[model samples]
Target: MADILLTAVINKFVEIGGNLLFQGGGDLYWFKDDIDWLQREMRHIRAYIDDAKDKATGGDLRVKNLLKDIQELAGDAEDLLDEFLPKFQQSNKCKGAICREFAMQIEKIKKRVDDIDHVRKTYNIIDTSNNNNDCIPLDRRRLFLYAGETEVIGLDDDFNMLQDKLLDQDLPYGVVSIVGMPGLGKTTLAKKLYRHVRDQFECSGLVYVSQQPREREILLDIAKQVGVTEEERKDNLEDNLKSLLKKKRYVILLDDIWDVEIWDYLKLYLPECDSKIGSRIILTSRNSNIGRYVGGGTSLHVLQPLDSKNSFELFTDKIFHFDNNDWANASPNLVNIGRDIVGRCGGIPLAIVVTAGMLRARERTEHAWKRVLERMGHKIHDGCAKVLALSYNDLPIASRPCFLYFGLYPEDHEIRAFDLKNMWIAEKLIVVNSGNRREAEDLAEDVLYDLISRNLIQVAKRTYNGRISSCRIHDLLHSL
Candidate 1:
């Protein structure tokens, strides 16, 4: 209902503004003032509807009823405009029956809109959130959302084991991969390991080798990070990287490597050498076969979910970030409920944080906490679907439409980076910088990375040059 209603409401406004009646003549005469007023009111209602998505679906009876009212009125607008716009456009003069009908319909729509506003205000059903998420701001594009996100909980053992492997002076130069399901802390653990041990190596570099990683960019990124010298810079990628790494005892982190083909390419530059320098390459992926292929399966860490005690501990930390300490002492009733909520998280760190985000929005009270716990049901992914809903609700107003645009593609579809950017431009979701295509493309790419960081979507493939080549969302997020 939200998708269909939003599309109808927003698209109709665009059409009405761009149609023949919206030209100069009609600007002075028929449909201009009335249509503009209608558009403005509908815009407010659209914002409310966007905000009310969670309430409407989250068992809020009042919001559900209010949405039905809005939906009916929007349907009336669609039907009335469908009949009126064509006839109004066909005729130059407005002295006809069509003009009178549309005018009356628009007035009725306005009155209904006003009444709905009054009711929502009286009942406090209106969204009062002044807080905005920094997921993706359309006006100001932020490229890297994953930085400094390595503040993790309950990975001490994983970190220690991986730390031992990386710092092992007797171990030969090799790869240490972390394997786990999506949303597990494979990437997070790898980041923590790199930060801890990066200073030990002579030099280091990191890159996310998504499914179709571009070889040149991968080599160039590592070369730049490891600080290639003037002499090594004089040679090609293979020689430069090989000369620098095989000699300097560098640590490299290749995240999310899908194919051994990526290893096949990188292996050309990284040679098997003695254990003196203790050079290590850390990797992360869902398929453990990549681990075996890269290092003959020597990695000691496959990231598991936090145990029961750690799950509650992580949840407690995130929930308390939103609530004060006094509330923690006051709400002793929340402990059991908090544990119930953690149980629904099923031990995945991503699930726990996201669930914590849901609780973060509400008051630290039994009623609010129980409401969140009730929504979790039995399954972990069900809790994750709530994460999608909460994340979508928390998205910046302008980014909402662009985020929903992902739903139009087929499930499990690998969306091309440029193609999605062009579509967004054509759809007017992305504002081109003075009609400059390059600027718009950059902004669109930034939006993709921001959403990826939020865990709302996944990177399906990366270009050989290390840009997001194609992307997709999980089946759960897609089901949303």
Candidate 2:
């Protein structure tokens, strides 16, 4: 940890030193000696810092804090450089005044650097001139596949239950709807279930029903996927689809359905035969209302966020596996850090997977993991937050503020269910019906359940009768 910090500080000092020496239009020559001394001194401290790197990284807080001080002092010097740059850049008549400003800032930075150096020497934290360690840089992420295509964790019961529904030959023309907030693996479950049952069907078609529905294109896509060629469609797209499907048992997967109208438009195009035909439609959507609208409440399958055990498994799987086929043997310390990191993902598969990929390229040391952990909120948002933002933006106006209030609490803190409702009541967020005499608490409870159903807040515990007992918001959602 100290080594990396010292290296970064040294590099920054080198950069500032270069700017002072070369980029200042040669008018700042008077300040060159101070800048050179700063750069050289930082490099000298690097060897000493590197010698104790293992100790600082081994949970030695004092050593870690000292390196942090050095890094911060370097930042102070960088800030002084920033302030001096514009004056050098400007075509000012008073070069002496500009040099004086530079002199004053450099003197302050020098004093701080001198104090740090004195501490180093006093502690016998000295390094020979030739000692320097290899500097490994930090890493970022690349475009990778979404969670839907990856090895799924924490959906065993869901898979079994949905598989039974899809494969039941006795069932009629069935529609099985899988609904949850974005990135909760609705499409992934649909795809997995489709793969499991499609072999039993005479024909299968996986069609993506995006927010904007295009009838002709969708019909053709369905046909193309199910081996119904364009050449076979002599009749209109809809009539031809019904004629083709009615003659054969089939499974059709509609991925990402936004509006109910798309289903209404497409349903007739499917076979109208009775349940004996064994034709089925599997739909995945973020909107639960549309799930019920199309498949009825009985047909809706609300996907839950992954529990801790499975979430960690999925997260580790993403972190270790690479093209080289080498899986990381994570240390216990790294594993503990990883668990804390995965907790922030709130059991959303996509978020966990995305965060794991971000960390995979980094060094598998505690400091590396800690560095990533510190900036996790923003780092996670790179891929997963857009999906979360959709759920946030779609939230009802009244519920939005209530949802934002969850962020105020520490991450993963459980809130008393009644206390949360009463706070909402106190805030007047719950709209009461004048006609009904029920307390505003009832309506507030509705808001809480609404968020839970949407997969935003999770139900921590339940009453004997299965009412919400305690509730907690996800760390990722808390960031939102």
Candidate 3:
């Protein structure tokens, strides 16, 4: 709540300050002192804003009120610039006149800052200077490996088989697809295998091709990643990409593919012939139809849910964090409750992970864990929404809108990252990082990756050069 609002305000302040300092140029250079002061003061206030956000999450009313006032003050500052900048630009010989025009308003701006400072001091809002504790920083290259280490269980055989298939020289240039229902970790396994085998290729890239495939963009990405350079021209993207990879041994990973048509389009650029040694196309799809369509016979690997033993390992590890002493000392009644909860997870990796996260945040009591187990019904009766909601609740307040925006799309819709970046900006949903000169779209991409790291959304497709081409929201998350 209040944290989201304050974060939005801080982003706006930084955006406006950046525009004034850089884009204002000589037209308003006389106000350098004012701009510098504003920037410095804004930077100073940022620490307190973050501190208040942490405290505000605990439901502190005073901190909430302070955040509201700070948001208003930030809005006022932006309004002053919005009004003054355009008028100044429209006027002839306006530099001196603009400085004079903003003279009084500058004082008002400083006074607002002072008022906010007074409020910060009065409330005893100490700058703890801690970053958002909720967002777990993720490295893209190591995402699946991290999941495997922390949450994945009993996939050694699956991993070995997939790895063997990828390395088999007999099928140097062909498609390998992974098919399964949602939450079965198809994307996770694909990622792990891709990272493992990619180094062996001359050029390797992973792209996400979601339900709604953008043929031109995807082809262009593949071309770029495989070492092809193209200008603004779009006349022969597929042909150009094909020609580039025609002689090279390349590996490409496509994730969350929803249609055979997507592969058919991408296949135009990718060489799928016996001549291309060590080149492979690996993909993951939820639809079994897509698997049959792309690789007609025996090429699809149908992912299975964790078996009972593996499920228990994952559940207990999440609940107890591998503390053998803790598990050993537990009462028989509590141990039974643990088994009941794991049983209710129904061997689904996602269900176990979400349940564990929720309970781990609660009091470690038999009664508390049992209550969760009871609420979480068996098999289909276990509402996927409830499990997802627990995961959603764990996200930083600043990250929620970015995750919820997925709900706006139709079920099974494939969302393009470029379109999503603009949409996030148009909706004013993303918070810009201070001192970050990257475009707003880049910041939005960062937010998307954060969601991906939290397993909230799957990377549906990426470009050959390692940029996210498209994404897919879990159908259950769409219900949320």
Q: Local distance difference test, per candidate?
A: 0.70, 0.71, 0.68
Which candidate leads in TM-score? 2
* Backbone Cα, N, C clashes tallied per candidate: 4, 1, 5
Tens digit of per-residue lDDT, candidate 2, span 270-359: 865246777888988777777787767877888888999999888867876764433346577877998999888878898888888888
Q: Order the candidates by lDDT, highest first — what do you get?
A: 2, 1, 3
Q: Order of all candidates by TM-score, from best down to worst?
A: 2, 1, 3
User: 2 or 3, which is superior by lDDT?
Assistant: 2
Candidate 3, residue 243: how far the Cα is off, in Å: 1.7
lDDT for 306 in candidate 3 is 85
Tens-digit lDDT track of model 1 for 1-480: 454454455556665666555676652255677777777777677676755666766778887888889888877877887777666666655655666766778788889989989877766665433434435222100112137755678988878888887777665446687875566777778888887788988888888776446788778877888888656765676687787676787888888776678888888887563456567888887666678777765663567668899988888788777446734485567777888878766677878887788777777778987877766644435545642454565556556667888889987788987788788767656654255668877887877776765456677888899888888865445655
Residue range with the least summed lDDT across 10 consecutive positions in model 3: 137-146
- TM value for model 2: 0.60
TM-score of 3: 0.48
How well is each residue in 1-480 modelled by candidate 3, as lDDT tens digits? Answer: 333333454455555555544454565555656766876676567556656765765689988888887777666766776687677656523565566768888888889889888888887786644434444433332344234533346777888898888777775346687876566677777877887887888887776664345677667667777777655236566666777678788888887775567777677667774463657888887655566677665667877668889988887887777466667787899888888877766567877777788888887789888778767643333435543444554455556657767877886689998898787776556746464436666778878876764456767898999888999875545644
Better of 1 and 2 by lDDT: 2
Question: Candidate 3 local accuracy as lDDT?
Answer: 0.68
